[model samples]
Target: MSDSNKTDFTNPSTFILVGIPGLEVAHVWISIPFCTMYTIVVLGNFIILFIVKTEPSLHMPMYYFLCMLAVTDLVLSTSTLPKMLSIYWFNSREINFSACLTQMHFIHCFSVMESGIFVAMAFDRYVAICHPLRHSTILTNHVVAKIGLALVLRGMMVILPFPFLASQWPYCRTNIIPHLYCEHMAVVNLACGDTRVSSYYGLFVVFCVRGLDVIFIAMSYTQILRAIFSLPTKDARLKALETCSSHLWAILSFYIPGLFSSLTHRFGHNVPLYFHVLIVSVYLLVPPMLNPIIYGVRTKQIQDRLLWLFTHKGI
Candidate 1:
């Protein structure tokens, strides 16, 4: 194609995203599943939040962390899924440059916040398991509130740099993000200017936030497992293991796919685009869908409260 026929890479207004060429069919395949998952994720998290708030028996440090987790799940899913579903169902894929950056900002912010929440929960679990004698003192309500504030502050400090760096780059070119959601890397890649700074900031934030959270979670689980085994009675061991199991499952499900997707984006972009879309969707959508189910089924208190709420409503 001649220069005149070539799409302008410098004119943000003229750039239209033709969305991964022939993969528009994927939109049809994705729409139903995404909508269903979003419904379940929102409803599930809301239920957990309600149960945690309403049930006096659940007003402990552990449930407090669980409530935070539910809030994070709600925010995280809300950030991306609505826009994605609109694109898939309505074929409205054109995103403004500023809007894209805004989406990217919230996506990173909530994601980092969720990671911070996970670390906080790990610490809570650690106190409860390893320092049971001092659990109440160590993880007092005041301390939990401080931890929540720290998580928000740390998440903002980690993720805000990406959007700042992104804003510096003039979107002299395409506005359409290839993926369903406005991912930081995807949006930055569309920038006509240098993205090295934005990319570096993104990497730094991911490593510092997600990486540290994963390590801390690992350490917490190590101590938790040791404590469980050290229990004299089988019933005691089983109970300890049971308490941590849901958390372990949640952490693994949240992090593993994200790590895989990051690795693939960094090292395996040479792979098929379809694979990229599939993996990204899985990473973004699966955790929210699974989180409520995992916690709901594993925590008996939440289950009982949910049942009570529904039964009362029916009456």
Candidate 2:
């Protein structure tokens, strides 16, 4: 074969992303909900940030962590949704290899950061409910700032290898990605060489970020529940448990779908590709949309501030 005719598998200039397999006809219709969800994610998260920033009374450890969660959700959703909507609405599916890597890094980085934020928030709740007297001293402003910085650095350091390992692979087989975005495994799976290192490292990252964080969160909530029950009055116990409901909902919304999607994508070979893609898309989008609402409705301080802001036209 001539040099020009020979396939250049070493590195393709671009990878074509299939928005959703076997759902070409519904792309337009599908874009509607996705666009709506993206809108909600943006507006909702921004609102949370705004409310937390302008209201001096809401300045505390819990709201600080809520702000972190909101920012994480914003980055997490923005990293994937715009391109996905572009693929669905405009049929623009070409993603540069470098850009793909960038998207992959942001998606995973913010995901891990979100997980870390959840753990921090759970610990905040634990301290607030379990040791109400020392809550302020325990989670001081300096401590909260340090926790935020640590979460950022931890996520970046852990996920830094993802794009590096992915980029090191030789994608000689094909430049077509069957999923919506440049998911780490999806991009790595396109490589022609052995992907054991990348696969194993990805799992390691999951364990470091998700597995350990989940354990910490569970432990924190366990101690929290014990503290709530030991309260002297029924009303005190009910009020304390009510405070955790929003956090519980946010945790469930994020981890349950995320875990389900991750498991099905890895082991459920019988599951349809489109089904997996849809699940992942929902997993990413739903949490951002629901988190702010959950916190706004369930947390009294945020609810009061939201009302005041709306009533006063954000004055």
**TM-score, structure 1 vs. true:** 0.92
Worst 10 residues of 1 by lDDT: 11-20
Q: What is candidate 2's TM-score against the reference?
A: 0.96
Score residue 63 of candidate 1 by CA lDDT: 88
Q: List, residue by residue over 196-248, the lDDT tens digit for candidate 2.
A: 99888887876666989999999999999999989999999999999899999
Indicate which candidate wins on TM-score: 2
Q: Mark the regions of model 2 whose C-alpha exceeds 4 Å error after superposition.
A: 1-6
lDDT of each: 0.78, 0.90
Give all candidate RMSDs, comma-separated. 2.6, 2.2
